[model samples]
Target: MGGPAPPAGPGTAGLRAVRGKSIAVLGGGSLGLYLAGRLALAGHRVTVALRPGTPAPSGIVAEGDEQWSAAVEYADIGRLRGPYAQVIVAVKSHDLPPLLPALAALGDGATEYVFLQNGIPWWWRGIAGDGLPRARQVVGVVVQHSAERTAPGRIRVRRTAGDRYLCGRPDGSVDAALESLAADWRHAGIPAETTPALRRQVWTKLMGNATLNPLSAITGATVGELATEPATRAVLLAGMAEIARLAERDGAGVDNTPEQRVARSAEVGGVRTSMLQDRLAGRPLETEALLAAPIAIAEEYGEAVPVLRTLYGCLAFSSTSPERNPT
Candidate 1:
């Protein structure tokens, strides 16, 4: 309805100044805007980085399950300068490569880098090379916020789940920056929390992505549709089972069973997966990170993922089909 109140001496109205930190959210998409707005509401000095040629809005607007607006600083990622206390990398997994140079230039070794991308991170298990600045503290966040960006600085959240954000370190250790950020989000009325089992959460979220993302892109179906339709639901369950086995073998056991995961997907209603959105917009699908990477890992460990392989093949074929409609 209304925007956040003015900061009281560079921090939350009644809180100490030190509670607020300088934060940069690097991405202009739904999750990025939502994080920027909510963090600003929590009295942090928030800046949002937009792509070149994208207009920077004066502030962020969030509607639907959460309703609030907050003024935030904006800059082009290419030109963004940072001595920021924390930098939240909210870009999609496929979009990270070109941004690496810019991200590597941000801040110093003490700056905390919180990566909030979907699927597994490149740095996990050295599955991919790391080009991030050396000595910088990096952490992962598994987000459960269901949101869509309607415009450059506007978002609509369809929060149907209990957890909104779960932040943690990869080594099952606690870090003050992540804990404080999660607390700030909670103070802003977001359901944020910290976890020691971040990798397990990563795999838990991956179970859904590995199953629903590619299927949604290929079938042009919503999350609920894929979870409820008999034909797609069977494939979804089988894929989840495969991912679960893979995760277990990799030492990051997922907490939910296939049935439970499907029930959660059904609860998200009609929201489309990000991969489906990318396909509809004729952008390259995140098949490499979300699907193919996991498949590769499964192969190395001798895990069977036939269902996931089939889904990946269908999605790859559909995304590149000469006759497929872009929209």
Candidate 2:
């Protein structure tokens, strides 16, 4: 309703070009695929760089006249190079380091990165060790598309680019380029907005992710089933409160009450959080960045997060065998 809040501390990058631009998505996940489809459909030439381990379904590659099928490649950045205006890092946050050297190697001086992963931006700067040089060139994106690999390359994607998506600069101002990109992406889904207060967006998503993801995984339940009873919602609220506390102390706000977010979770019925899906499939969860990281930060800020600690323990204990916890 209002203009985005001003940049909090020393990090924020505005979009450079509001006119036509070529972009490459760095991963081949459902997010990348959906983005490719939407961008291409909107008349923007889009390329997705795929690594050997990245999953791709047998979905037909229908782009261009030749219609060459798309599959994963084990090529390095120099080999599978991108000379585009923007390079999007769609990989998991933990898996970011492997590609950073390549992106840094590009060193075009004009290429910007759009971070499509969840969690805090400050955490990202720490992980990559490049700080604001990398941070300022970043466009923080919030995505609400439910995705997973159905097979190798063929992802069974929903028609929406994503249900909720946004891109914002570090200082919280909208560049014409990001606004245009959002408009182009709308052909794929309903993108929420662009703002400078991306911290709020990221934290809102983290609250939902940190709470519901672990709960669902521990109990093997869907979102609706979890919220069906008051007890589960209470546990979730405790987790949310911990995040809210840390976010405020960290100098950011979700800018909404806990009750408002809790209600939104209820609306996404019959869906299991990503952690539940990962645990069931025996894949590693984003535990450090998603659950433990926020709780740990709460401690650093001289606050208590007992409920989060307990929930984190419960999730860690239940989602895996005792052997996994080094006990």
- In order, candidate lDDTs are 0.78, 0.62
> In model 2, which runs have C-alpha deviations exceeding 4 angstroms?
1-21, 53-78, 122-133, 156-162, 187-192, 319-327
TM-score of each candidate structure, all chains considered together: 0.89, 0.77
Clashing pairs in 1: none
Deviation (Å) of 213 in candidate 1:
0.9
Kindly list the per-residue Cα lDDT of model 1 for residues 1-327, writing each as its tens digit: 112323212223443234778888998888888878877886889889877788778798888776778899998777778788788898888888787666657777777888888887866763234556442267778887688887768988775535457777767777676676666666655566778888899899999998898888887899999999999999999999998998899888998999999998888889988887777777777888888889999889988889988988888788778367434
TM-score of 2: 0.77
lDDT per residue, candidate 2, 72-168, as tens digits? 2333334555556677777766677566656754435566677787565443334346522355566778776555544444444332222567677
Candidate 1 backbone overlaps, count: 0
Q: Which regions of candidate 1 fall more than 4 Å away from where they truly are?
A: 1-19, 127-131, 134-136
For candidate 1, the TM-score is 0.89
lDDT of 2: 0.62
Which one is best on TM-score?
1
